[model samples]
Target chain A: MFGRKGKKGNYAYTVARVKAKKSQLMGDDAYQKMLMMSLPEISRFISETGYSKEITSMTGKFTGINLIEHATYANMASVFTSILDSATGELKDTLAADLERWDIWNLKIILRGKSFGIDLDSIREDLVPAGVLDAEDLEKLMSLDVDDDIIANYGRMTGVSIPQSVVAEYKAQGNLAPIEDFLDKHHFERLLATIDSRSRPTRLYQEFIRKIIDTINLETILKLKLEGIHGEPVMKYIISGGKDIDKKLATQLANAETIAEAENDLAQLDMYEFIKDALGKDTHSLKDIVAGLRRYKMKEASTFSHLYPLSIIPIIDYMLHKENEVNNIRIVARGIDAGLDKEIIKGLLVI
Target chain B: MAADLGMIMIGAGIAVGLTGLGAGLAEKDVGAAAVGAITEDVGLFGKAMVLMVLPETIVIFGLVIAILGVFVLPNM
Candidate 1:
């Protein structure tokens, strides 16, 4: 699969295929249609569309809204599998490793949800299958009791993932906080590891990851302020991989009386435009940062598409785009079921 | 003087032939991409086909050089 002919030109073929797939993703028209359906109707709709096979197989075992939920996971897993299956280089393996963020997410969700005695099926449905964890493995994970499974999984993921101390923190606090922080930290770190050193293409990818980390930290800060947390305690929660957020700066931002001041402080970076967009004048929504990450990654992928025609970048780009597409579809489907406005649902979509 | 012309003609042929290799290099990706696009959406097939063949222009230029037999013209 590593085979690729030397092109005076870079990976245009892979880029072209990725571009074609991106174009096939559901746009506003479908998003609008999706907002009008009930959960059962959504399942039927997905059954008729690209996600049909997923919906059909799951329908008999689980029905109604849960069908849409499980089928969403199935579609996400299938898409990730397709991308990994299609990938062709050393870069392919690296990209796949980065996508393992899903495992961390799944483990946390299972541990925290079960700890609170939430039903397995409901917790299972909330997972976004954008990572390397298979549906069977996820089922195995979901079946286990919360805290033990978390520690055991931490040991399993230790060499390539977060260490045991973090899991110990989870056990100690009995809260998902530390474990979730570790997962976010590892996700960004893994993204940093995958880039080619000193290349413009990889640098752009790295920046995108960094920006996302910073955004998440900012959101955490916002959440703390809303809860009236103060001083050094809130500072401890900040993840360290963001572009400009060091320990002291993170704490200061968290302690700020107004989130707008924090936004203003972050406005001078090269990604000034994106920071501005995320902060949105007087009212900041770090949710905007999450959306910004998706957009930024798309821009980086398309920009790099002209290089390494059949290399790993296109495959990675396709995977990211596909995950985002599936998420948007689920939102639209759920929004429709919830009787939300199409325009409002559209605003909520990350696509 | 005549020998110099023969040498230059052979040199030009090699140069032009290598250009086909360059064109071939470009074609592989374009072709694969076009095919993949067609698989996803049939409507893109025609336009993708046109774009995929675009690099073949390099080969055409090389062919023109060979057909003219640059030797037929004065060495000036």
Candidate 2:
């Protein structure tokens, strides 16, 4: 998928197909209906909707939550693969780059699982295998015993290796923070590098990427503030290339004496406006705040996707929506199986 | 004025031919998108047909101009 000659994209056909697929995504009403159903009924409903293939393939081996989880992962992987397959030229490159985050995601899962002494089987369950790394690649990564070995092999596999120093830090401190931070930075930096700024669509795509970087940086700062860590360490986790939160602004935000100060500074940015009210509310978890920010990003993506129907925005929009759909379904199915309250499950959804 | 008549015929041909090409170019993208949508949802077949044929009007306009050039202009 690399070094393709033509930079042209099949925007019209891809956008139309994606829009049709987007329309088929489950709506709020569907989620509400699912919320009320039992696990078996939800499973039946989802299988009938489109996941019948995945569901039937894993029939006897897995049941209940396992069945739903595995099926959703398989379905999402195939959908993502189909999307990448459907595009041509530069569009495919951009998508393949963006989707590489899933590989990083799977890596993170494996690292964390290995570090925490979780077994390979359970660790495999959380992986999406939606990126360049397929099940076999993940299986290969999972086979290695040492975390450092996994890191080295991952670097060789994807070519975005964490530095030996960071790996050493991870080894010494037993904290995956530095290494994870490196992976996040590598993901965005690689995306920035892959895109050329000449075309309008790509420039807009860069803006989208910048916005994502900004939000994630903001999220990292907030998480650090919550942990009560301050000064130089806070800056370490911040990813650069954000539109508003550039390196200078990031340093300033990091150097701020208190979390409240950071929040006040964040309140000035227009993108942060949506989450302004709930910034430091005691009742809300970091997950809620992050989810709120993600929802805002999705809204921005949706608006832009409509404005530029024949651009990369629509694909990004569809991908985000699809990912959210998968997450929402998983949440509902798992929540139902776990006997969680309907209101609680609804609260977790990004809709 | 055999030469003048010949030039008028050439002009008529050029108008129809160029516009037909333009219409075809315009329809290519739309037709692809339409087919894609139709594949995703067969229900969109009617809507896709409407959108796909909308470009045909360009060809019709070209045809009108060609007719005017060939038939009416000489009389004028």
Candidate 3:
């Protein structure tokens, strides 16, 4: 128990504000309404909600689903930044570290953009500045010519160690997968490293991250197996530090003859009961599994927040809930724009 | 009689002080969570206020005992 002594900031006030925002997050009913509307109508519906300011500001320049997508990303960044500003002490550190995933994401985006020779303006448009990097830092990164030296410089500037070998491998293979894998691995390894299992809240946080790692590893294995790839190559992509599945089990799961067999192997693990339904149907794709994992994580966070209301769990849960809402809305809007059917688009949503 | 009066006064002081401490401790978490709930929905102001003060009952009880000790019990 981290005793409530010398703990800076007023979590009560922050938590209260977060809860207020959480309650206002759009529900299934709103999504249903948005699903039927045209792209412009979808944008209008969003303007009436929390996203009104961003939508209004961008309306002149961008329109349709593109405007909605950019607005959603921008709003997410602002909301997260506000949360970071409100937090202090351990909570702030935890949130900052957790949010650093966005930095990794942005780095990946930049790398991918460079790989494909995409222009700076397009790359800049795709960025979601929800991490430690402020807009100015992102602007600087975007302005720099995409190459190994600039990438290394970006890493040094951000204090994120992008291993030279990953860049070398990217150069050798002329592919982004190696670099992406390295970044993903680096992020998770660093994330798991920060979590101290001694404290209850942190231990819960550790479990949350571990579950995520496990899910990522499982999805990787399933995807690789489906592609008729297996053995050591599959093992290379599997992230460590999972709670239910260890390295050996992951390797075995990866080597399994089929997806169903892999799911069967997972069924023997502790988290089988929770993830079984997601893996039950043969028709279930990697997207379904990933969505199931997100749902499970959210459910676990909600339970933890209920059990420990005053701690960091509730705040983290609220953050995840906000992210999910934005993502779901984006998916619906984009799906509608692409002329996808209602049910199909609905399936794409995590909510 | 002087010593007896001093002892009764000390007991009254202890009653109020300790119970007030207990009440403060109890209200700390409740008040925090109540404030949070209220912020989420302004309509919950009334409900949160009620919940926030519920722990004060302990201090009130303590005050009652202290008063009893100082006045009625001293005579008894």
Candidate 4:
């Protein structure tokens, strides 16, 4: 919704607060302690940390992993909301676009929930309104029964254009993947378009985004490779505007008959080193590969933020770190609940 | 001699004024970030105070130049 004109932003103040908040996020030691704790014990431990307020408020309503999951979503939404509220001018615009990932996430949840006839309250619990969309907007979406009407309302509210053909395909096949892919691609495209790359810092920010898009595209290809589906299906999910891993490379990686061939193609890229170990392992899961890619993205963000502390990179870094923290806690809680081994749980964490 | 003195005074004024402006610009960013840090953690107030005053050195240097011009240059 923001225009292309660059305005003065409160980067110093916002980034400082963000960095302080980031410093308070849980570290490896906390994760280790939580991994050894029981479900209730984990809940208690989480209650003692940043999520205390969220957990205490919901204590009577939910418990165990369910409580942890919902409380994390609540905490995430409030955290993002407060940050967005505090930011001014261009910074706020960039953050809103970046956090729109969560909007896409909430949209996916609503779509999936409505399609499968899931209960409204539980789906609401799963929704993290960390994006531009607020709880009220989500409530309106939840009240709508038809997917098309919900999508239409979302477009009107957010000003995001969803092609009729994509919606028609989603309707015809009853599949949500295409819709999800389109939304994600559109979000990144919008971000790139709104950014005027004339300034050096913004140019760096754009480069950072391109790197992330590349990693995401790589992750998608690896996922499709593992699923034994290739060619057209994999190509359909490829997002445009990446630095590397364009259509040609993506096709080569996707159409490779053997994983080794795909690895050979990937080895030529700079990012391959970051993910090589994950890809080379005999027992590689898409989860492990994705975690590796995410770590690299985090690394890139940190370096960029350090290089330009006054830029938007620091805020993006803080956001990524906070999201990782939430995801890590959820993983530990859910892993314990599922009776998964401790080592396995450790493997799944991006940290 | 009086006109020369007047010019020297004007030069001194420019030195101090421009430097003061620069210092204010520098401190605007630092002070803003410092307050932001302090809000998140009260314990950081002392550190923030130190950083917030760091930019004051620029203005101090400017003041010294102005002092030199006003007190020493004329005497020289």
Q: List the residue pairs that clash in candidate 1.
A: A10-A308, A10-A309, A11-A307, A11-A308, A11-A309, A12-A309
DockQ of all candidates, in order? Answer: 0.46, 0.78, 0.55, 0.85
lDDT of 1: 0.68
> True-contact fraction for model 3?
0.58
Docking class of 2: medium
Question: What is the C-alpha lDDT profile of model 1 across B1-76, one tens digit per residue?
Answer: 6887787688668868887898877877678678767766789988997998899899888877765667454435
- Cα RMSD (angstroms) for every candidate in the order listed: 4.3, 2.6, 2.6, 2.8
Of 1 and 4, the candidate ahead on DockQ is 4
lDDT of 1 by residue, A303-328 (tens): 55546435556666676777777788
Q: Write the per-residue lDDT of candidate 4 for residues A1-351, one digit (tens) a residue.
A: 123223657888988999998888999999999999998898899888888899999999998888899999899899889989888888888888888888899999999998899999779878999887899999999999988899999999888868999998988887998799999899989999877798888999999999899998988888878878878888888889898777788889889865677888899877788778877888766777788888888999999999888989998998899889999998998899999999999988888
Weakest 10 consecutive residues of candidate 2 chain A by summed lDDT: A1-10
Number of the top lDDT candidate: 4
> Candidate 3 docking category?
medium
Chain A TM-scores of each predicted structure, in the order given, are 0.81, 0.94, 0.92, 0.94
Per-residue alpha-carbon lDDT of candidate 4 for residues B1-76, written as tens digits (9 for 90 to 100): 7988898899889988998888888888898899888888888999999999888888788889888888888888
- How far does residue A20 in candidate 4 sit from its true spot (Å)? 1.3
**Positional deviation of residue B19's Cα in model 4 after best superposition, in angstroms:** 2.0
- lDDT for position A220 in model 3: 85
